[model samples]
Target: MYGGVAAVKELSLIVCRGEFLTILGPSGSGKTTALMLLAGFISPTNGDILVGGKSVASVPSYRRDQGIVFQSYALFPHLSVRRNLEFPLEMRGVKAAERADRVANLLARVHLDNFGDRMPSQLSGGQQQRVALARALIADPPVLLLDEPLGALDRNLREQMQSEIKTLHKEFGITTVCVTHDQEEALTLSDRIIVMRGGAIEQIDTPEGLYDRPKSLFVANFLGEANLLNGVIPLPNDATPTSMLSIIRPERIRLAVPHAPTLADAHQRQQANGVVTEVIYAGALRKYNVQVGNNVLIMREHVASDQQVFRPGDQVRLDWLRSDVRLVATETNNGVE
Candidate 1:
């Protein structure tokens, strides 16, 4: 077993150059450990990690030329922002003149151009984070690794920093690997997400691909809120067959009118009926908990300026495109409840 328990089993992953990839999973799913292995903080017992098409399993962390930003900011309290930014360059013996230019440029890039004289304790959490980011980038490493670098900020600051980080990545075109437990953050920031479980890779795909076509039930439930109903394959449609575990996203489900035509017909494809048990108004959208026979289904609809509202105990119908229904492999102990 790896990490004293089967943390990762035969896991292999590849991150393309200049691609922003986020590893997402619940706590103890080995997302951080996987990143640590790639960063040379830990070694994989059974698999190899490659960076830039070269095996990095044997490369020491310091010589790997990868920039890392951690959750703690990890700035030196005694040093000014400028000195902190220059520390990495100093270690590399970069001349004083070039280091000054690089640090000045990085300070501007991270939006701390005038804060160079400030100590870490004198800055706000967000500003300190920006300094940490600038310090990491001062050396201009080929790869960047961020381990929940935005976890300490408030909701507003976190969102702002998310955009800032993305902008910085685009500006530098650096290959970045981010490890995050926040599903929404992963979905928003990553060009692609690698979902992990039990220290193993579950699925790696673009956010749209993973959300629209989950390969397993674990991924379906992890990526977003899924209204999964256990139902037998009644029969294969003459057109296409479905597997045992199939799921549909809440947003894809729609409210249907009883008199609508069957879903098989082209004009009536977006129609199905269910009984509404609960209605939740969540500002931007309304969520309805509907029951179709023994299955409890969830439907989400955007709150329109002029829309009829439904209440609990209302007889409602659910509808969605057939193409939106995704078939997935069975999941074990998904812990979604």
Candidate 2:
């Protein structure tokens, strides 16, 4: 709690060994506070943290055996890459000869073999990031903590670093806990994701599970693009309960020419017709906003050579298998209803 306000409330989780778990949410969602609590940087007012079957809640950040990578790439600006890598080993009383060997191998592993003599200021943003990651793993800690690790990089660079982090995680087999607001990053790198909302856990599931079958309306909209189907279209009698909300992903809805002939599986599909209100052309995919009744439903389709493109004001038919529609819980009184 910070100044009598609970940043995380009734939070309980278990991170499996060698698992890559990511805490994902928007600003003020307590994701970072949760990471800090795990890192021993902050104390939990009413709970204990156990690492490897022992209590570590009272352990200081420096005393806990863990690796941390900060968003700023907190490298020592005055030291050369080699010296920076050696600092941790030196503090741990490792011999000079062994430190040199370990530093040499790690520099090569991060693909900075020839640049070890350069200072932190001399390297590019990506290079600095690599150095930070290498330093964190140098001690070979059992746990790795990442706080918004990729937020400082550009789009292309962020994607590249994502692959690098994934590869290193596989090779090291270290249990990792990462915090980020980027849904794509969480989905791409996590074995499982925890969606946090208002200082509590909204949902915890595999990336595919969270995206395909969110447990709440907030999760459905947070993980990816969702089309809320409540009062917008007629649903089957048993499809959704009064306490649940119906939603479908944009990509799950198929677009066809207006008045198109019904398909063989028509009995299993729900169809609707609407005018195309907007058309978005992303390089590899086309997105359409169709006005059906009083709601604007979004649909996405891959751009193909033979695919017909729709324009604004064009009449279009949308259809999806009834099974594709998901029923999620609704929020009430600032909690799931």
Candidate 3:
């Protein structure tokens, strides 16, 4: 127990060999604490932490042999880039010449070949992150722990580093555990994501499964833009429906010119009438806020230069395949997760 409060409960999942597992949750969700427990920085109150099928519950952080990269770069400000990378090898008693070779190879691998002589203060945020990653991998540990590794970087650099981290994981084939509050980052980088709330496992699935088939309202709303229409809605091929809140993705919604000719191929499925309330121009997609009765729904369409753009005050019809509608927990859902 953490301060007599359960910081994590019913948390169970295996980080497969060479798989990237991300623990995703909002603040105070115990994601960071879980990572620390896995890394031997903190011990679980009652539970076995197995590494390679052996319990390491009493092992200290330094003895775990797990590479860790903190949110802060954690590089020694007084050291040059090369020295920071060499420190791990030195601690392991590697000879100077061998450490030099490994450091050089890692520098080249992280695209920091020319910045080896510079200090951490001299490098850009992205560069420092790369150095931190290279250091984590320098010893070639079988398991890696990353605690909000990209939380410090800006948007553009965050994306760039994300690609780099994925490449590194693929090249090294290490079992990795990442803790992050960024949903997009988890979706983009994880092989399997574990969504945590109130220190418990809400759902654990691949990025696609979590987004397309979330069973809870909290997960449905947390992962992406979700429209929860109240009461019964169309279910699959059958017109007979069940009573529950209907969850539909914004992209699943299709908007068409009202009273226009219904195309024979598509857009003839389940339909509804609404007036455009707002149009948002997001670089690659146009998000339309539509009002149906007293409900306002969000519909996202791909932005095309040649397509007609619907504006506010325009009457539009929203259509979707019955298969796209997913029922939220009718009885099991009690408020949020």
Candidate 4:
């Protein structure tokens, strides 16, 4: 707790061996605080942290058997790339010859063998990030901690590094815990994602599961675009309780002219009519905001050569498979371990 307010409360999770787990949330959602707690940077007021079945909650950061890659890269500016990678091994009392060999192997592994003599400032942002990752892995620690590791790069570079990180994770098979607010990053890299809000876990599931079946309204909207069907439309089936709300993805909606011929599978689809209120032309997809009754429902479709495009004021019909709808709680629950 900080300043008498609980920064993270009743948070409990297990990081399986060789699993890539991501803690995802917006600012002040307690994700970073949780990472700090795991890294031994701060001791929890009540609770224990177990690594390899041993309690290490009170251990200092330096003594923990884990590697961390901070957002800043945190390379020593005065040292060469090779020396930076060697620092951890040196501190662990590795012999000079073994340290040199390990540094060389890691440099080559990160595609920086020829640049080992260069300083951190002399390298580009991507290259420096690679070096930081290499340094983190040089000691072969059992767990790896990443704190917004890709926040420093541009869009294209970040994509490239994401692939790189995924490949490295596959190769090393290390148990990794990453904390970030980027939904795309979490979805792309994690085997499982923990969505946190208001200092509590909103949900924990695989990326596909979380996006497809969020447990609460906050998670449904936060992870991706969700069209709340509550008060906007009637459910095709009445299986859901009144306390829950139905939601559908924007891409699950299909749009057509109001008088278009009925689809072949109309028997299994639910249909609605609305006037197009807005049309947004994204490069690869079309986004439409259609006003049905008093609600504006969003619909997305890939831009295809033979597809009909609707504009504002156009009458459109939206349809989706009856099974595409999902039910979620209207509010988040006070989570437990």
lDDT per residue for candidate 3 within 1-337, as digits (tens), equals 7669888776777889999999998888778889988988878888799989988989999888889999997999999999999999999999999999999999999999999999999999999999999999999998999999999999999999999999999999999999999999999999999888888878889999999998777788879978866532435453233434677899998888988777674654677899999999989989999998878899988888888889899999888877788776643322343
Task: Tell me the whole-model lDDT of each prediction, alpha carbons only.
Answer: 0.83, 0.93, 0.87, 0.92
The TM-score, computed over Cα atoms with residue i paired to residue i, of candidate 1 is 0.90
RMSD of 4: 1.9
In candidate 4, where is summed lDDT lowest over 10 consecutive residues? 233-242
Ordered by TM-score, highest first, the candidates read: 2, 4, 3, 1
Cα lDDT of model 4 overall?
0.92
Higher-scoring candidate on lDDT, 1 or 2: 2
Relative to the true structure, candidate 4 reaches a TM of: 0.96
RMSD in angstroms, all models?
Answer: 3.1, 1.5, 2.3, 1.9
Q: For model 1, how does the per-residue alpha-carbon lDDT over 1-337 read when each residue is reduced to its tens digit? A: 5536776665777788999999999998889888888789877676677877788898889888889999999999999999999999999999999999998998988888899999999999999999988988889898999999999999999999999999999999999999999988998899999998876778889999988888887888888878764452242353233434657899987675666455555553444457789999898989998877778888888999887677877787676666777667764333322
Where in model 3 is the C-alpha error above 4 Å?
A: 231-243, 265-268, 330-337
- What pairs collide in candidate 3? none
What does the lDDT come to for candidate 1? 0.83
Q: Which candidate is the best by lDDT?
A: 2
Question: What lDDT score goes with residue 169 in model 1?
Answer: 90
